[model samples]
Target: MTAAVAVIGTGTAAGWGRHRLGRLVAEQTPERAWFHVHPPHHDLWGAREPVVCDAQLLDCFAAGLRAELPVVVSAAPPKPDGPTQRSYAGLAALSRPSGRILVGVHPADAARVPFAAAGCGLLSRAVPGLPTGAREVHGEVAVEALPGWMVGTDASGEPVTVNLPPGATVLVCGAGAAEVVSTVAVTGRTVGSVAGADVA
Candidate 1:
């Protein structure tokens, strides 16, 4: 069956988190073909193709669904100030019932993401103590590498952390944070082989 993971939030942190989470989901489920919907700023290493525009994104999701693959989408949170909120809503609308939504937000802005919390299956952040639910993945910094941060969580809910090479924090806040977001992305998947396909 077709599955999808949408990483939605605001600012550069959200962007980087989306990239990290998408990669993690892809890694967890390599048996199926994967498509990506990412902004121009982010670079996706492996994907059958890159989907641009809302129409193309929807089309890719539909195609992946038909092919029983997975579509990884990175979108801005559905907020009034967010430029791509409409796209986020569209993705949410289309991925209902079986799709997963991972919302990444700053700890201070936790209360501001009410719209997403209504439907999101996972919440990723640097700190813990969010309103309790079965869908929250809390992350905290455990160490500070020379140029990277090691994020880990000891929260009661699902723990999301991944091991990464030192100083690999280019696109994400840190490797640890990336792992946290990614853990939420693939929380319950079995988790890729299209080569040379245009990954925009």
Candidate 2:
């Protein structure tokens, strides 16, 4: 298990978003008000590994894990399909580990996954009154010292204030060829961000 988080992305318009790209493009509309969550700073001394997962696997993931660890799930928008929106509640439930945090990504995902779920504490983010369910932690605050499990995302530039350290291993999921190089440049890690299209 690598130290990583799911970082799921969804949008009404297809071209505006993708799980592979770290940027979320929302045109000038109410949807633009959605929130995005960034990855937690690397905690070298900590013993927990943050594993990224598909939103489909959230419920079953907690079965064999440490109960005391935290899970920081991203609150991105849900797919416009009815079935996709309905199934999101389970994923939202998984985000509520003992210690949790919310980073803005999408309004639909954020609405379904609130901080008041099963085992969540008071939620917080960078904006005031933005993330309705969680408490607001204004400004650029660091969560590196937190000792527990965490799952989250790097939706775009709005929430990601910290970049990954050097020598980190990343599995890129989609791209033709050039995208792989760009992800490596931004992340500064030797292991590249796997292109979404390349995943077979």
Candidate 3:
């Protein structure tokens, strides 16, 4: 049997002192789903991308994420939706950062987090070889999918390719999480599959 898998999105909840880490489990009894998690308050708020937090809260969250098959999907918003919009400014606190990613992936697991840092327009470049049909929240761009990977034009309009791994889920929030997880619930596949079965 496949081990339990969990996906989490980090952000500061509006009107709350604690930070929120939205969790999506693929092995709920009734049905797999996303649950709201309000961790203890920490002074490390409003830091830069891949924000770090208090060791206590970070350890707690990290412990919760650990499993036989653990997967943490921390979504760092490239740009804030608005002044009031929640964002994951503290992901690096819980996970280590190599270059631009804050992550915790089991080496045996075929999972990777390749996302663009703030101000970079071509998000697809972060995860080279993305399939077609990648929906950019900020722009309308057409991308093509190769047989084993994907290709898209980057900030300088240069062709960039990305190869997404199986079971990779794009970290999202609220309604977006619901939509993405619902599809996973029905199909028994990751959102990356929706992007293209070749990758997932």
Per-residue lDDT for 27-61 in model 3, tens only? 21112122111111122222123233233333443
lDDT-sorted candidate list, best first: 2, 1, 3
Residue 40's lDDT in candidate 2:
36
189 Cα displacement, candidate 1 (Å): 20
Model 2 CA RMSD to the hidden true structure, in angstroms: 19.3
For each candidate in the order shown, give its overall lDDT on alpha carbons.
Answer: 0.28, 0.29, 0.25
Prediction RMSDs, each to the true structure: 21.6, 19.3, 21.7
lDDT per residue (tens digit) for residues 1-200 in model 2: 23233222223333343322223211212232232222333533333344333332233322212221123323322222344323333333333223233433334343333332222221122222223223323333333212221223356522212223312343445563344333321111223334211110
RMSD of 1: 21.6
Which ranges in model 3 have alpha carbons more than 4 Å from their true place? 1-50, 67-99, 107-200
TM-score of 2: 0.21
TM per model? Answer: 0.16, 0.21, 0.17
List the candidate numbers ranked by TM-score, top first.
2, 3, 1
lDDT for model 2, on a 0 to 1 scale?
0.29
Q: Per-residue lDDT tens digits of candidate 1, residues 1-200?
A: 12323322235567677567756654543333212112121222211122223334333433433322122323222232233433323333322122222323333433333323222211122212111121222232111111111233357643233322211222445655434334222211111111221110
**Model with the higher lDDT, candidate 1 or 3:** 1
